[model samples]
Target: MKQRFLITILVIAMFSGCKKFLNVDPLDSLSGNNFWKTRQDAETYTREVYRLFREGVAIRTGMILVGDLRCAPVAYGAYPPRGDFNLLSSNSIRTLVNTPRIQGDINTYWQVHGAWDVISDWTPIYKVVQAANVLYEKAPDVAEADQSMSAELIRKYQAEAVFMRCLSYFFMIRLFGDVPYYTNAYNDVPLPRTKDVEVAKACIAELEAHRNDLPWTYEDPANRAVRAMRGSAIALEMDLNMWLAGIDEANKKMYYEETDRLGDELTASNAYKLLPMENIAQVFAGRSEEGLFEVPQNVNYGDVLGNIRRTFTGAVLHYPYIQLNQNSTKSELTYTDGYLKKLYPEEANDLRKKYWFDNNIYNEDGTMQCFKFFNLALGENNTTASLSNYFIIFRYAGALLLQAEALANLEEGSQKAEALLNQVRTRAGADLYSAGTDKNLPDAIFYERSKELMGEGHYYYDLVRSRKIYNPDYCYRPISYGNFVQGAWLWPISEKALVNNPHMTLNNYWR
Candidate 1:
């Protein structure tokens, strides 16, 4: 009789365990120990962190929360009952002022109060940063089979992490002036707010250093691994430098110079090109070219979240109405009399007017529904498809406009600026380029930006950089408070972050 040899495989699975598997003392958690060891491990871990980018930190909440749209005219606890949507009303008394809600509400204080509120809940982003930090610091020691390739991969991932960190800080400073800067994710010490000038300088330095390291393409050669590309970094650099230019005098000059240099680079690279005027909507229809970067959304992915404008502007306000079905669920063809009357182009031949807004389109029941935001397939109740379109953070159009703005600010002749502005307007099918006054070069650019980038969130920044008060009726009303400091454009720090971190200080204007 042959002796049968039985090989037993004992697989011990641990969830959220320590960094090391064998040294696990049973009481120690297994989650932290087993992170980012192999290429696959690093990729998987990085994907989870990338999901935050897909979810909305960079685009949806961050940009829309600051720009003009719907307004809340009533106070916080008033009869109308204001929430996030109504926070933009100037007269509203209810103040939940923070970084997230600063532009829209009263008491736009730039302490730690609201600043922290917006970003504190971004636990996933921080986790991604932490993972990336691990890859940055530890990936080299893996004694990888392909040494140079491994180091390059590690640097690419690290560059992404740095991009996200710097991007977050950029917004933080924009919303809430001086914010605590942390290079290491594990640091528990509360950091004092760095000056805006210093913050801009530091972020630009980081971006410039990592620009060459990022890959030009996103599609991974091995197995279709998606990651941030060099184009994304360049787009971010253009935006950061452009924004930084708006602050003070000397830094303004430096940033403008940088913006011109980067903008020229972006144009020359040929990696990104502007989408045609007709196909512009298709860019936002899904994953398309015009988007330098976008948060991915799908019904199956459980990432279908409503955009701020579509939620409030399309649903509650009448500009573009949401059509409803028999099930009481929102439909796509919502119309508003005000929006049509105010924004519609005078020339009937203008294709963009028809492309962007709704007309006399009707529903099955003969009810007139505006197709401005029509997405019947993705109703409110449907978890699979969301009405909220992919929020476009940086687009090729923005790059072109930034280039135009930079040129306008740098050059003496209005002809160059006018020509640059015309490039965008003419593409949009607007006659303003030919007819509009040349004297109002900046205003022309501003109006063109408002119309072209409408509902894409750029108005408030234009207002801030120009130092012009936003027209109340034309735009959203300005909210004010007694303690509110002038030029307190940034949001106050969140009350929570201040309580947690001791070294953090209130912004100068707010203090």
Candidate 2:
């Protein structure tokens, strides 16, 4: 048996202390034989895939800006240094995309702050896919080169690599409708956009085959949810199924049934559980059993580095959590009264209402703050503080709601749906479901998600997938079915995508 060399030198160099190394770009090095030689090399390359995904989403709070901000429950307040809150809240993609940034122009806050990077740039995401592709193609060679690398370990690394690649494509389709998909490690052949449904189907089959290769959980507590696990793979499958069900509506029943079954399997594993309401702070702190997958952040070690203030938490929180001025009492945004009421009615006994809000959820005033992502940091003079919550992508409770949703849409599965829905509701100390003549189980489940996952970046996508975006009864900013069919919901693809690839086209609805 030979030694397993460490990749920590490259990892540390990538993050900091080496500007020249980053400038040269190291992802391409993975394809060379000089790099991928041992089990540690395979492990390190997989970690790089995760790092690329985190960077892609961390840009301008990229995931939240696209996933939660658009048509979210937020309203702009009369505060300095605000993004296009109205544009985001109203789902105005064309105008927002076209907004120009001129010096000294407060109007260009969104552009000046890199809204284009969030809405258009797929480069970082593609980098994730590219790295994953390289890992998947090259990991097997490690077993041949290093006697210590076992076939089982090599398969696990390949499974993790494919998982990240599929996850990246899933995000791309949600944001841009269709995207260029590829799998060969270093191939540079120009490609056209594949139908997102085809992309989803291909990814689902790939993950289904490798799902058992990953473990249900890691023995190391720190690695539990942050690393790829069987739960994460299944959760991603559920999400892909739901997204397909939304687009490929003719066969939605099949998708929903698959989602329902996946949800049951995830629950039956008993590998995760929802934390008590009092421990809600712990839940957001990351690495908890509830966190199925999250982009880890630790302000102390500077893991998030200089991007702390630009996170999703920064947009909705104010003084105490973050101080913009001597009297920074107001958040830059607030939830709308109508939307707040829709989720948590005046008399609703929801614990989230108490734990997640400051002042009032219905308060039209900008002083209202969402405490769900608030993890305070006190800076010099207490003037430079910011929240340190992990960028949560998937959690156990969210999986439960997804299951509830799938079952509600299936034939005669409403009873099972209520049980799953109530599990989350019961954990929150909110009222458990009891059937009523006036009750709508599906809507209730959706509303529960709206309240529970509020600001965690799931709301806007939920609206789009459920076609609640077409219903004024459900969506605060409803889009007509015709407009939706025209791709009005998708962000415009970056013009950069068309520079070298003749087959690339933009989302013309926004144009």
Candidate 3:
């Protein structure tokens, strides 16, 4: 009955005034006096925050465009070597959006319209913040009205609300540098952008207070990693600190220390872990033991969201993963041979190379497709069906690597860093690490992340946070330090943001 009621609220959310208020003005949605009387009401509203976040990312393939493609070494494949991938590879933002849209499959494959809108707009993400704010403000009241809703349960739900809010802000800070920060319920004041460092600090404090309110794991199998847990909060806290350590030089050591300690705590908890490389499919299939937090996508339940063509698999897979009749047998995109060689030398005995790529792994042509985000095809070969996969936001391996990265930034911490880095390498059946003449421990950890997290929408942000976006050795699309200071790395704020707010300004660097 509870599950069905939640579903019913979701259905109503799509059609009723609830949806309108959430989209247009979150403040308006909370005007109701009687809405906060039940545990079910609190729970239903909390789930919408997750749904809104999934929609924001999945609908337009936002993460792939924002996270993976920028500054990365990639080339066009079976499709015509169009300007889109080349532009992204070169960090040519102005030209990429302004160029005439390609006709036919290329246009659809790129989803240029959606990409352009998502890159400029922050509305979708703010919608999530709004919903979360509502829940955070109102969840406490549920305990007063519902005899069955305990204070602990209300606190847990409120913690989930804050988790979603912090997660949304972290994503925005990476993309836009600083964004307008708020937590007051029904806040409608027009505001200017906050400094990214300030936003990070505030979110860190907020999350630290509420992290323990969440459980280590869920009793229900379906809620395992999909719901926020202690592991999820800790993992997010680690990433936010790492981001802070990268940009805020004066306080970087403190940020690094916090990340290292939190990582130790997360691992020591033993609440999450890496699955064997042989069970790689299970890892991507969602709700796995390794998942810290994920945007759920289940094709079996008719709950699949977003365009597959623009997803990581959609951009790379061909033939068997997609229908041959309407799609090319060759992949639409592939990593450059240079990048591939840099990530995986021919001499390295890594099992990931064998498990994740096809025979033409080195091909500059679009023939190479990654099998990391996919499992079994939905139908027989050549069927127009998507493989079962989930949009993983954070997982145990990523957290491990993040911990390794944080340690590497600290003084006299190389040995400890190597230990953390090798944990991932050993799992991949690759030779364990020792700092060598050619590659230092830091670069090894960076490339290990590059190799392990190839298509998961993390590499580009990794480059940005590490200041590697300007280094030609690390980035294929290196911008000069001058441009970086001019906010070249930040996405141009949409004109829509300035419509009602007098304090709003755009990222003039793009202009």
Best by lDDT: 3
Q: What is the lDDT of every predicted structure here?
A: 0.50, 0.76, 0.78
Best by TM-score: 3
lDDT of 1 by residue, 471-490 (tens): 44434344333333353455
RMSD of each: 9.0, 4.6, 3.4
Query: Which 10 successive residues of model 1 have the least lDDT summed?
Result: 2-11
Better model by TM-score, 1 or 2?
Answer: 2
- Candidate 3 off by > 4 Å: 1-32, 80-82, 99-114, 300-306, 377-386, 436-439
Q: Least accurate stretch of 10 residues (summed lDDT) in model 3?
A: 19-28
What's the CA error at residue 125 for candidate 1, in Å? 5.6
Candidate 3 residue-wise lDDT at 464: 90
Candidates sorted by lDDT, descending order?
3, 2, 1
Report backbone clashes per prediction: 34, 0, 1
Using lDDT as the yardstick, the better of models 1 and 3 is: 3
